[model samples]
Structure formats: C-alpha cells, structure tokens
Target: MEEKSGDSLATVLVAGAANLTIALAKLVAGLIGGSAAMLSEAAHSAADTVTELLLLVSVRRSGKPPDERHPFGYGKAGFFWAMMAAVATLVGGAGFSVTHGVHEISHGEELGNLTPSYVVLAVSFVIEGVSLSKALSQLRAAAGRHRIRPLRLVRITSDTALKAVLFEDAAALVGLVIAAIGLLGSQWSGSALWDGAASVAIGLLLLVVALILIQSNLSLLIGQAAPRQVETGIRAVLLAQPEVEEVVELLTMMIGPGSIMVAAKIDFCDEAGAAGVEIACDEVDRRLRDRFPGVNLVFLDPTPTRRS
Candidate 1:
C-alpha cells in the first residue's frame, strides 16, 4: 500500500509540473500572438494544472487512516475531488475559451504573430504527450491484470486518479491539434474568424471529455457494480463448496476502485441438517474471500431448499 501511494504521488507531481510549465508558456504565446486558438490552449493547460493538483491532494488525503468521523477511511474523498476536478476543467477551461472565442468572432479582430503561436503549441503538444504517456503506462500496468483493453478498463476500473489524468492529458493533446488547424486556416486565408472557430472547437472537445469523466466518477461515487466476470467467478467459487447446495441470490457492488462488498444468500441441500448448513455457509464465505481479494465485506444468509 505504501509503495502504491508513493508511485501515485510521483505520477501526479510529474504530470502537474508539465502542465504548469505548458500553461505558462501558452499564456505568454497567446498574448504575444493574439491567436484565439493559443488562448484556448492556455486555458486548457491551466485547468489541467489545477486538476492535477487537486488529484494529488485527493490521493494524499484518501490515504489517511480511518478516524471516528469517517470510519471507512478517506478513500471516497478521492472520488469527490476527482469529480470536482472534472467540473473545474469544464467550467474554468472550456467555458472561458468558448466565451473568449465568441467575443473574438463578434469583434472581428484579425489574428497576429503566427510564429510564436506555432512554437508554443508545438512545444505544448510534445510536453502534454509525454505526460500522457506516463499516465497511460500506469493505466496499462494496472489494467493488464484484469485482462481488458485500456479504454474499457477506464470505464470499469476503480482508479479515479488514473482516469482523470488520462482524460485530461488526452483532451489536451486533441485540443492542441484543433488549435493548430485553426491557426493555420486563419494564417492561410487571412481571416481571423477561423482562429476563433478553432478555439470554439477545442472548447467543445474539452467539454465533452470533461462530461464523460464527470459521469464516470459520479457513477463510482454512487456505488457501481463489479464487472460481470468478477461476480461470476465469485459465484463459481461459492457454489463449489459442498455445503452450499446452490446460490439463491448474489449481490455485489463496488465500494471503491477495485474493491467490492458482497451480499449473498445460499440454499443448502434438503438433506443437510441445521448445523451442517451453518458449516457450509461459513465455508462458502471463507472460500469467496480466498478467491476474491477485492471482496471487503461478505454476508451469507443460509436458506433451506425444498426436497426434490
């Protein structure tokens, strides 16, 4: 657990530093070049930097030991922080860029100084890609154990920190591309409207990405289900117990990333006496814990089956 926490903190620090540097550079370039696209990129980077910081804080706080006020530990605090980060990205970054883009379009100001804008954007893209690669590597390592593709794993994995970082970095890269295209269109055609249009496109892209992240985090917050395969595997393990004649009901929900709480009712064979049935249920619970390390809480209710 300590090793994992240290690794996560290191990842967030590296990514956050990259974002801060890129944001500063982009903001300067945007001001000097008067390119709407550059300004949008600046906004996006700034939001990313802030969100990364929030993620770092969340990770640290969530690692705290359980206290009287919060007996479950601070793990869920990470989810709430991640959700706020997504909202910040959408509102502070996307909202600002879209508003500025509209203003530029309305005022019809010609873009100026293309050279600086291009330089900053190219550098930003490289830096953002590096940061994204780190997050992706972590994600792949974590997801590989589950034997699922990275994209699908993001949907089901309990690691909100990884998900938030991946989405932000990916969006930043795409936003950079959009900004570049818009800047080039304005430069080639000598119409400033193209620059503003590009900013709008980048904003929209970020908005969509942020919304998806927000929805995913929210679902996890509300307690989502463990993957179907995991639940099935747990059921199989339980049924293998001789005392467990059959499983009548099984309920599993994710209490945190990669952690689940299970509630099940099992029926014993008709011939089994009360004492034997109790022993069977206990065996089933023990086996389930052995099979599914992620099952934090397991409750087994024994029921008698009708004689066939």
Candidate 2:
C-alpha cells in the first residue's frame, strides 16, 4: 500500500504541473487570438488543472490512518473528490465553453490573428501528450505487477486520479485539434460561426468525459466487488493449503482505490486446533497481501462443518 500510494501521488503531481503550464499558455493565446473556440480551449485547460489539484487533495486525505470517526479510514475521500473534479470539469469546461460559444455566435465578433493560437495549440498538444505518457506508463507498471492486461487492470483497479489524468489529457488533445480546425475554417470562409461551432463541440466532448468519470466515482463510492479472477485466485489458494478443508464463503469489496477488504469462511481439518488455525490464517493473510497488491485487509473465519 505504501509503494502504490507513493506512485499514485507522483503521477498526479506530474499531471497537475503539466496542466498548469498548458492552462497559462492557452489563456494567453485565447486573448491574443480573440476566437471563441480558443477561449473555450483555455477554460477547458484551466478546468483540467483544477481537477489535478483536487485529485492531489484526495490522495493526501485518503492516506490518513483509520480513526473512530471513520472506522474504514479515509479511503472514500478519493471517490468524493474525484466526483467533485468531474463536476468541475462539466461546469468550468463544458458550461462556459458552450455558453460563451453561443454568445459569440449570436454577436459575431471578428477573430484576430490566429498565429499565436496555432503556435500555442501545437505546444499544448506536445505537453499534454507527455503527461498522458507518464500516466500510461504508471498504469502499465501496475498492470504488470498484477499480471493482468492493461484494459482489464484499468477496469478493476481503483485509481481514480490516474484515470482522470489519462482521459482528460486525451480529451484536451482532441479539443486542441478541433479548435485549430475551427480557426482555419473561419479564416478561410470569412465567417466567425465556424469558431463558435467548434467551441460548442469542445463543450460537448467535455460533457461526455465528465459523465463517465462521475459514473465511475459513484460505483466506487457505493462499494464495488473485486475482479472475478481475483476471487478465483484467492479461493484456489485457500483450498490448496494443507490446514484447510473447504472454503464455504468468500467475499471481497473495493474499499478504496487500490485497496480491497476480503472476508472468508473456511472449514479446517478435523484435528487442527486453535493454535494451528491462527497460524494458518496468518499465513494466508500474508500470502494474499503479497500476491495481490490490492488485498490490503483480510479476515478469515474457521468454523467446523455440520454433519448431515
């Protein structure tokens, strides 16, 4: 848990720093170019920057030790802040972009020189790509550690901050292309409506990303199950142990990003005593935590089998 937590924090910090620079560059280009689409892009970048900051807060808060007020510790903090970041993206990025685009379209403002916008968009694309690469690299390392494929790992892991950075950077790259196209089209056709249309499209794109993130956060907050494969692996290990006879029930829940709580009911050998059971349970707990990075907490109940 310590190693994984540290890596996650590092990834989010890099993303946040990258977005900060991207946002400032876009803001300058938007003002100089006076294009609705470019201005919307600026707002979008700013929203992403804020999203990274919120993720950082979530990571920090969630790392706190368990307390009486919150018996399960501060794990859920990640989901709460992740949900807030999604909402911020919707309002700060999509809302302003669409509304401002509509206003500009209705009022028809002439777009000034687009050279600065073009230069900045190109630079932003490169920077965003770099950040996306960093996030992807970390995710890939995580997948490798778990011996799972990339897509499947992403589906099962509770790394909301990493997911946010990957998807947001992808969206940012796409939005930049759309903005550039809008500017070029408007310049060639001598109509500012193209720029407004592009801004609206960028807003719609942000809406889609925000909705996905919101749904993911809601599911995690509500408590999701671990992967089927993880459950199967655990059951196999328990059954293979010499002290165990049967695994009556196995349950698992994702209590936080990269954190799972596991419970099991087992029937041990007829001759095994209390001392033997304790040793077996401790061994199993250590094995599970070592083999599966997500299995941070495990509880075992050894009960006698009822005769028919």
Candidate 3:
C-alpha cells in the first residue's frame, strides 16, 4: 500500500512540476502575443498547476497511517482533495476559458507577437507529453498486475490520484492543440473569431474532463463497490475451501486507493464446530489477502447451515 501511494505521489509531482513550468511560459506568451486562445490556454495551465498542488496534498495526506480517530487511515483524504481539484479545474480552467472567449470575440485585438506564442506552445506540448507518458507508464504497469488493459486501468483502478493526473494532463494536451489551431487559423484568415472559437473549444473540453473527474471522485467519496471481477474472485476463493459450504452474501468496498474492505455472510460445513469455523475464517482471510493486494480487511459472518 505504501508503495502504491509512493507511485501515485511521484506521478502527481511530475505532472505538477510540468504544469507549473508551462503555466509561467504560457502566461508570458499570452500577454506578449495578445491571442485569446493563448490567453485561455495560459489560464487553463495555471488552473492545472493548482489542481496538481491539491492532488499532491491528497496523496501525502492519504498516506498517513491509520489512527484511533480515523481507524481506516487518512486514505480517503485523497478523494476529498481530488474532489476539490476537480471543482477548481471547472471554475478556473473551463469557466474562464469560455467566458473569456466570448468576451474576446466582440473585442478582438491584433496578435502582437506570434513567435513567442508558437515557441511556448511547442515547449508546453513536449513537456506535457513527457509528464503524461510517465503517468500512463505507471498505469500500464499496474494494469499488468491486475490483468487488465491500460484504458480499463484508468477506468477501474481505485487509485484516484493517478486517475486525476492522467485525465487532467490528457485534457491539457488536447487544449494545447486546440489553442495552436486557433492561433494559426486566426493568423491565416486575419480574423480573431477563429482564435476565440478555439478558446471556447478548449474550455468545453476541459469542462467535460472536469465533470468526469468530479463524478469519479464523488463516487469514491460516497463509497464505491469493488470491481465485479474482484467480487467474483473472492467468492470463488472462499467456496473452494473444504470447510466452507456456501457464501450467502459478499460485499466489497474500496475504502481507499487499492485498499478494499470485504464483508461476507458465509455458511460453513454442517459438522464444523466453532473452533473449526474460526480456523476456516482465518484461512479465508489469509487466502484473500494473499490473492488480492486491495483486500486489506475481511469480515466473515460465520453462519450455520440451515437445513431447508
């Protein structure tokens, strides 16, 4: 678990650093070039920098050891911070991009210096790609351990920190492309409308990504069930034991990133005594913890077999 948290922190830090660097560059270029799309991109990158900082806080706080006050540990703290970051992205990245674009459309100004805008965008793209690639590589390795694909890992993996960074960086890359297109189109046609439109497009893209991240974080905060495969595997592992007769119910929740809590009502064999049942329960816990990295806790409600 510590290792997982470490990896998440590392990913977030890489993205955060890259975003901060680009934010400053974009701010300068936008000011110098006076392009609406470039300015919107600058605001977008600045918002991303804050989101990364918040995600950094989430990863660090979530790694704190469990205490009496919060027995489950500070794991869910990441989810809360992730939620805050999503809101920030929506307001700072999306809201401003759209509103600024509309305002620029009517009051378009001549782009003063296209050279700085072009250079800054190119540099931002390469850096953002590097950061995004690192995150994806980590996700790919994790997906391998889970026997799933990278895309599925992004969707189903309980690591909220990685998920947030990956999605945000991807949106950033796309936004850059849109900004570049807008700049080029406006320069070609000698009208600021194209640049303004590009800003709107970037805003809409960020909005969609932010909403998705919000939903994911909200679900985690509200308590999401483990994946279907995990539940099935747990059920199978229990029933395979000789002392176990039937599994009445199995419930799983992601208490934190890669930390799962499993509770099940299990019926042991009819001849199994209390002592034997205890042994069975212990064995079940052992097997589950061994089989799944996420199965941090197991609660088996031992029930006698009812003769129907």
Q: TM-score of each candidate? A: 0.90, 0.93, 0.97
| Candidate achieving the largest TM-score | 3
Worst 10 contiguous positions by lDDT, candidate 3: 1-10
Rank list by lDDT: 3, 2, 1
The per-residue C-alpha lDDT of model 2 at residue 135 equals 83
lDDT of 1 by residue, 97-189 (tens): 898888878875777678988898888889889988988888777667666777777777767777788888888888988999988988898
lDDT winner among the candidates? 3
- Candidate 2's residue-wise lDDT over 11-51, tens digit each? 88888898888888888888988999988999998999899
Candidate 1: where is the Cα deviation over 4 Å? 1-7, 270-286, 305-308
Q: Please identify model 2 stretches exceeding 4 Å from their true place.
A: 1-3, 303-308
| Candidate 2 accuracy as lDDT | 0.86
Q: Count steric clashes of candidate 2.
A: 0
**What does the lDDT come to for candidate 1?**
0.80
* Best-to-worst TM-score order: 3, 2, 1
* Model 1 lDDT at residue 7: 55
